[model samples]
Target chain A: MLLSPSRLRGLGSRVPPCSSFRPFTAAAAAAASPTSKPQVYLSRSRNPYLNLSVEHHLLQTTPPDSTVLFLYTNRPCVVIGRNQNPWLEVNLPLLSSLTARTKPGDHEPAPTTIDLVRRRSGGGTVFHDPGNVNYSVICPPESFDRDKHAEMVVRALRGLGVPGARVNARHDIVVDVDVDVDVSESDGNHGANTFKISGSAYKLTRLRSLHHGTCLLSSPNLGSIGPLLRSPAEPFIKARGVESVRSPVRNVGVGNGEFEDAVVAEFAKMYGDPDVFCEVGDEAGAVDGVEKGMKELLSRDWIYGQTPLFSFSTYPTEDDPRERPSLPSDFHLSFEARHGQLSKFTFVNASSAGHVDIPSSSSSSPLDGSRIYDVEDWTDALRSYGGTVNSQAETAGRWLNGLFGTGHAKTQLR
Target chain B: MASIARCVRAARPSVLSTISKPIAATSRPVFYRPTQRCFSATPISEVRKYTKDHEWIDLHADNKTAVIGISEYAAEALGDVVYVELPEEGATVAQGDSIGAVESVKSASDINAPVSLRIVQSNVELEEKPAKINRVPEDDAAGGGWLARVEVDEQGLKEFEGLLDLEAYKEFTATLHE
Candidate 1:
C-alpha cells in the first residue's frame, strides 16, 4: 500500500505550502491510476535537512519495484556517515569562521554556519553548498546498481562539457586536473591533479535501496572548502566512520542551469519521460520532513553523541605552569569518549622528585644539567613519586571538556 | 513465564541438507538432550523455511523460540561482514519489520523479522567479530552465522506461510543469476 498524503505529510504543518511545489504524492490511489509517468519530486528546497528528508520519504514511500529520482542543492553543510563521529569528521574551529557573503558581497539574512548532518548511508563526510547539486535514485533492491546510478551523473557531466569525467574505483567521478579536458582547465594552483567532481553513498532495505551523491558546481570555492575538510584540531577521535580522504575537487559549470537540465534529461531517458518531470518546492522548509530532520541534525546529541567510542591521550609540553625545573616534561591526560561522551578521564604525572640527570626530549634540544623525569610513554613511563593520577584525570577532564564542551552542530571551518 | 530447562537441540538432517556440504548429505547424529523430546520438536525438525529477503528461521523443540540469520547465499553476496547491527533485546518487532542491519563493504543491508516476536537475545560475539558470519554461514555450530533469537510459537509458524521452503529458496536464488 502506498502512503497517504496525510501520513507522509504529517510533518507538513511545519513547512509552508510551496508556490512551486505541487501536492501530488506516490499515493496508492495514484498507483491505482494508470497512464501517468513515473513521478519525480524535483524539490526546490535548498535546505540540506529538508532535501534529505525528501530523499528518505521517497525511499520509504515509493513502491519497492518503482524507480524515481530526487534532485536538490543544500546550503553549506558538512554531512557525515551514520556511524561516524562528528568531532573527528568536522574541523569545528574552521567551520565557525565562514563569512556568509553572497556572490554580490552582501551577507545572507541568516548568519552563515557550517552544518553537521549524519547521513543514513555509509561514506565519508562531504561538504555541500548552494553551488552543488545532489541526485538520488530510489529503486527495488534487485534493480539498484551502483555503477549505473553513478554513470548517469558522468554522462550528464560529459554532455555538459566534462569529457574526461569517469567514476573511479572509489565510486568518485574524477577529472584529471593535470590532463586538461581542454574545456575548463582549473585556474588555481592547488598542486593536485585529480579533482573529484562527485562522491556516492548508498543505503538499502529489504525491498529497496537509495543511492545519492553530490556534484560540485560553480557556487562553492573548492579551494576554500579544503581547510574545513582537514582533520579535527585536537585529533582526539578514533571512530569507525568512513574517513573522507582529502581529494582535489572541481566545479564543472560556473552556473548550474546547463548541468541541471542535462541531469533532468538523462534521468528521464534512463527512467521515464523528461516532460513528465515537475518541479517541487524551490525554498527551504517548503516540504515535509524538514522540521524533523532539522531538529535531529541540529542537535548536539545526534551530531556529537552518535560518534563511535574512542580514546585519546594528551600530554603537556615544556610550557606547563605546573612543571618544576628539575622535573621531566611527562604529564599525560588519558581520556575515552563513547557516543561522544567522556567515559574515562585520567591524568598521570610520572615524575619522581629526584635530581637524577636525564637526556633532553629530542635530538634537537640540549638538556640543562638538571634531572629530567620526562614521561616517554604512558604504559611504561617514569614512576609517580607522590601525585594522584585519578584526581588529575578528573581535573584535566573538567578543564579540557570546559574549553571544548558541547556546542551547536554549526561550527567554524577556519 | 516459567520454563523447565533450556537446551540447544541440533537441527535435524533434512534441514541440514540445505547447506552445500558433504556432511549434510550423510546421516549426521543431530545432538539433542533426550529429555526435551517430550515437547513438539516435530514442527521445527521437519524443515526450515526462508524469506524472499534471504533470512531463515529454525524453530526449536518447544516451537516457542527460533534462531534467525541470513542465508549462506546472502553472506556470500555481501562479501566480508564488517559490522552486524543486531536488534535490541526485548524489542517486540512485527513480521516484515526490519529488526537490524548488516553492514559490509560500506553498504548496509537491513535484516528483517520473519515472524512477529520479541527479541530474546542477539549474537554478542558478532559485535566484535562480524566476519564469523562470512566465514561459516552454513555451519550450524555456535557463533557461525545466526543473527538473533526471537520468541516464536505455533502461531508464529503461521507467518511462515508465504515463505519459501529450502528447495524453493534455492530455486529463487538461481533465477537471480539470470
Candidate 2:
C-alpha cells in the first residue's frame, strides 16, 4: 500500500484510544541500549500496510544512527532481493493474474491483494502479507551485528510462545512438522521435517545504514515459491512441481490471541527507544529516495541488466547425428572471467544425439541414447581412445567443486 | 515514589559535578608547553596511522611488520561490500598508492596502502569469503583474515604523524552523523 508518512500521521490522529499502546519503560529501554531502539511508528490506515518504496525511503533519508520500526497489517506483497533477477525469482503468470485482478490507481489493495516490490539486498525471493509482518532495522554499520540482530528477532518470536525458534546457519528460522506418511514403520510417521518460517538477508551501504530481511508469522503459499523462480537449466524440473528446499510448518497466525498479543507487546518492548523520535522532515526525503529506487527496480534494464555470455560448439555422434534426444557428444567447455572471476561457462559438443556422452561411472549419465557404463568402464573406454582423465566432471563433481570455487573466488575478490 | 525522587536528587549533584570538573580543570590554557600527552601523536586509536589521503595503517611491534584492514568507519560508508581485491604476497606498495580494490554491492573501492611496504601475506580467506572483511574486520590483528601484511620503510613512519588519532576520528565520525 502507498503508506506515506503523512498518510500515517493523519490516520494516527483519527484513531481512538484503542490505538494508544504502552510505551516502553526506562529500564527496558536501557537494556536495549547501544542498538538504538528503532522508533515505533504505528501505521494507521484501515489496512495498516506499507510498501517497499516507503521502507526504502526510510532507509535512505533516516539519520545514520536512527532505527525505524514499520508496523503494517492486512497487506499482501512479493519482495525480491536487490541483486536478484525478478524474472528468475517471480512467477510471471501468477503475478500477471494478481495484477490484473487488483484495481488500478488503488493506493491500498483490497484484502487478499498482491504487491510486487524489490529490495536493495542480495538474496532470494520472499512473499509478504498481513498474516506476515516485515521489520527492517536500519542503523549505522557499527551498531548492527548480523547474528545478534537475528537472535533478537528469534527472541521476539519466543516471547510469543513459539519456543525453539532457532535460526539456521543460513539465517532461516524453521519449525519441525509431523505429517502422515505411507511408511512401513509402526507409527506410520517419518522423521520430523523442518519447514522454514522466516527468511532473512542483509545489505550494508557506504552510508553506514544497514537493511536486512525479516518475514514473520505468515503462512505463504509454499507451492507458489517454486513456480516464481525459473531455472533455465531445469525446465523439466519446473514442469514438475517445485519442491520446497526447506520443510513446511504452521504459521504464527495459527496461534491464539494471547500469542499474537504477546508478540506485538514484545516487539513494542524490544524495539522501544525514548532517546529517538520520528523526524517528520526526513520522512519526505525518504519517500523521494524510495520512489527513485522503485523506478530503478521496475526498470527492465536493471532487472535483467547482465547476461552470462556462453560460447560452445557441437559435434555429431554416429547414433544421433540428425538429432540427439538426450545428451550431446564431443563437447568442449570454456568459461570467461568478468570482474576477475568466472562470469560465464560455455559447453560445445557434436554428437549424433545432440548430447554429451557422460560415463555412467560419472555422477551424470549421458544425455544421448548411449549405453550406460559405470565409472571404471567409462574410464577404460576413454583410455582406449587415448583420452586422458581430468579433474573436471560434467556432473555432481563439477557442481560440488563449483560451490567451493565460486565461494573462494568471491572471497578473494572481497 | 518518594524513594525514586530522593535517588534522582542525590544523583543530580554527582552528574553536575562531573560535568563542571572538565571546564574548571582546563582553565590554565598552556598552549605553548609541550605536554607529554599519551595520544599527542595521533587521536584516532583504531585508525592506526594514516596517509594524507586518509588511508590508515595498523603497525605491529618492532615497527617493521603489520597487518592491514580498513577502519570500521571506512567499511560502513562503503556499504554492502561484495568483493575485495588485494595485492599478491611479495608485491610492493608505496604510501598513498592503490594496492587493491574493494567492490561493494553498489560500487567498487580502491584499497590504498597507508605506507610503502612489501606484501608479506595476503588474506586468501577473502577469495572464497570476502564478507569476512565486513563481518570480522577487527580479527585481523593476529594475522588471521587480514587483507595484507607489509614491511614499511622508515620514510613511511615519518608520514604517519599526519594521520588522525582516536579522538580526532570520533569527532570526524560525529560530524558525518550530524
The runs of at least 3 residues in candidate 2 whose Cα sits more than 4 Å from the true structure, single-residue gaps closed, are A1-38, A42-50, A72-78, A85-117, A177-191, A206-211, A230-250, A254-264, A271-286, A306-414, B1-178
Instruction: Supply fnat for every model shown.
Output: 0.28, 0.01
What's the i-RMS for candidate 2 in angstroms?
A: 17.4
- Give the distance in Å from residue A352's predicted Cα in candidate 1 to where it truly belongs: 9.1
What are the TM values for chain B, all candidates? 0.75, 0.65
Residue A107, model 1: Cα distance from true site in angstroms: 11
lDDT of each: 0.59, 0.43
Candidate 2 lDDT, tens digit per residue, A225-290?
A: 444443222221111111223333345443322333343344445555224332122232234454
Best by TM-score: 1
lDDT of 2 at B134: 59
Task: Give the lDDT of residue A414 in candidate 2.
Answer: 9
TM-score of chain A of each: 0.72, 0.53
lDDT at B54 for candidate 1? 71
Candidate 2, residue A40: CA error in Å? Answer: 2.0
